[model samples]
Each structure stands twice: as structure tokens, then as C-alpha cells.
Target: MKNTLKNKDISQTPFRRDVLKIFNSHKNAIPLSVIEQELSSYNRVTLYRTIKSFIEKNIIHEIVISGEESKYALSKENKDTPYQQHIHFKCRSCNILFCSELDKAITISLEKHKIERLDIQAFGICNKCNIS
Candidate 1:
């Protein structure tokens, strides 16, 4: 965690550390509501700014959802690099999203266009959901 903060040049303030902790504890992208619930003291504006800063620093990546609340997940690479190509699975039954790496390399070409990042999400039932 310290390495991540240092790499991003973010100060190790208590609030910032706590916010980063929340992200570290979860393997999936989470909504702001979850963070608010987990932390002791909640301030809407402060949380917003923290999240904004994290995003700008490439410490986290926003997950695009359809007709649902915004969610954020930790980036694959720490420093502003094109996020490692990976896949995110969103369980349709439980509404939980999990990230996983692809076993084989993927190549994409966009004629005359450059790609900064690639986000791929698949929706289905998670293991827990499938069991119950």
C-alpha cells in the first residue's frame, strides 16, 4: 500500500490511507456507498475529492455500468500505464463484479487510432450465486 501511494505521489494522510484500504480489501469494484458504510467517519465531499484524486493519479479505474451506480476498482498497473488487459465479471444474480487476468495475450488493432486502456466486462452468475 505504501508503495502504491508513493508511486502515485499521494500523501499518506489518514483519510487517504483509509480510503485506499477499502479498495485494497475488496477484489471487486465497489460503489461509493460501500466505502461510506465501511469507514468510521463519512464526509461526502471529502470522499468525492479523494476518489477524484485517485482516478487522476491512475490509482483506480472506473467501471462502466449500465443503468446502475458507478463503481471503481484498483488499476492493474500502478502508474498511469495502459491497464494490463484483463477481464471483469459481473454476476447477474448477485450484482458483484470480480476482476481476472487473461491466460493468453490479446492483440487489438484500431486502424489509425491509439488505445490507452481496455476494459472488458462479462456478466453472469458468480460461483457463490451458482451454488445457491
Candidate 2:
């Protein structure tokens, strides 16, 4: 976690570290409410600031699901690499958003334009939801 902060050129404050830890521990994208439940001691504003800083530093990225609250997850790609483009799967029943593996790096071309970043999400009932 400390390495991530250093790589992102962010100050390693206790609050910042704690927030980063929360993202590290979770496998799926997490929302503010879930983070609040885990970090009961910290207030909303502080958490918001920490999240905003992480976003600016590229330590994490936000996943937006329409009609639902925004969720955050760690940015695992290296700083030197081009913007990472992958897929996200959102479970309709449980409302959990998870990162998906890409068989190959996604690429796109538009005339003379080059695509640097992309955010794609697919929604359906998850395995757990299907089993239940």
C-alpha cells in the first residue's frame, strides 16, 4: 500500500494510508457507504477529500453505474504504461461491481484520433445471485 502511494507521488498520511488499505482489501469496486461502515471513526468530508486526492494522483479510479452510487477501486496499472482499459461487471441483484480480466489489451482507433482511456461495464446477475 505504501508503495502505491509512493508511486503515485502522494503523501503517505495515516488517513490516506487507511483509505488506500480499504481499497486494497476489497476485490470489487466499493462505494462510500461501504467505506464509511469500515471506517466509522472518520467523517464523510475527510473520506471525500482522501478519495478526491487519490483520484487526482491516479492511485484509484471511479466506476460509475447509472442510478447507483459511484464506486472506487485501485488502479493496478503501472504509471509508465498507457491508460489501462478493461471491463467491469456489475451484478444486478446484489449491485456489486467487479473488475473483469481482458484476454488482450483493448484498443480502438478513430480516424486520426487515438483512444487513451476507456471504461466499460456489463451488467447481469452474478453467480451467487444465480445460485440463490
Candidate 3:
């Protein structure tokens, strides 16, 4: 986490390190409320600022699904394209949001139009939930 902060040119503070640890511990995207609950002693403003910094520095990316609060996931390093272009999955059963990569990349083309970013989201019962 310290190395990630350093690479992103962000100051490595104790609070920032703790925040990153929370992100690292989870596999799925997480909401601010979960972070607040985990670090109950910290002020809300401080946590918000830390999250903002992480987002600005591309250490994490926010996922906004309709009718739900935004969630954040750590950005993968050394990718050719922006991580947001990858598909996002939301489990209907578990209500967990996560990133999923497809076996083959999807491509779209349009004449006289430039496509910048693409967001694809799938909703279904994830494997774990399907098994239960």
C-alpha cells in the first residue's frame, strides 16, 4: 500500500495506509459506509478526503450502478486500457459488485464517431451465491 501511494505521488499517512488496507482485504467493490464501520474512530471528513485522493490518483476507481450508492475498487497496474472498460458484475443474490474480464474483448465501431470509454454491467447470481 505504501508503494502504491508513493507511485501515485500521494503522501503516505497512517490513515491512508489503513484505508488502503481495507480495500486490499476485500475482493469486491466496497462502499464508504463499510470503511467507516471498519475504522469507526476516524472522522468522516478525513475518510472522504482519503478516498477522494485515491480516486484522483487512479489508485482506485468508482463504480456507480443505478439506484445504488457508489462503490470503489482498486485499479489494476500495467494495463493498456483504462480499467473502467472492463466489465462489472453485480450479484443479485449477494448484492456484491465486482470486476469481471471477458474471455474475448468486445469491440464496437461507428462511422464518424469516436468512442471514448465503455461500461458494461451484468446482473446475476454469482457463482458462490448460485451454489448456495
**Top of the candidates by TM-score:** 3
User: Best lDDT goes to which candidate?
Assistant: 1
Model 3 pairs in collision: none
For model 1, residues 21-124, the per-residue Cα lDDT tens digits are 89999978999999999999978999999999999988887887889898988887764564467888999988998778888757788999997766788888
Candidate 1 vs candidate 2, lDDT winner: 1
**C-alpha RMSD values across all candidates:** 2.6, 2.5, 2.4
User: lDDT of all predictions, in order shown?
Assistant: 0.84, 0.82, 0.84
lDDT of 3 by residue, 24-120 (tens): 8888899998988888489888988999989888888899998999999987743455543588899999898998776777778889899776779
Candidate 1 Cα errors over 4 Å, as ranges: 1-4, 80-82, 108-117
TM-score of each: 0.83, 0.82, 0.87
Write model 2 residue lDDT over 43-117, tens digit each, in one string.
778888999988888778888877889999877666687655689998889987888767787777789987677
lDDT of 1 at 105: 57
Give Cα distance to truth, residue 70, candidate 1, Å. 0.8
**Candidate 2 vs. truth: CA RMSD?**
2.5
| TM-score for predicted model 1 compared with the true structure | 0.83
Q: Candidate 3, overall lDDT?
A: 0.84
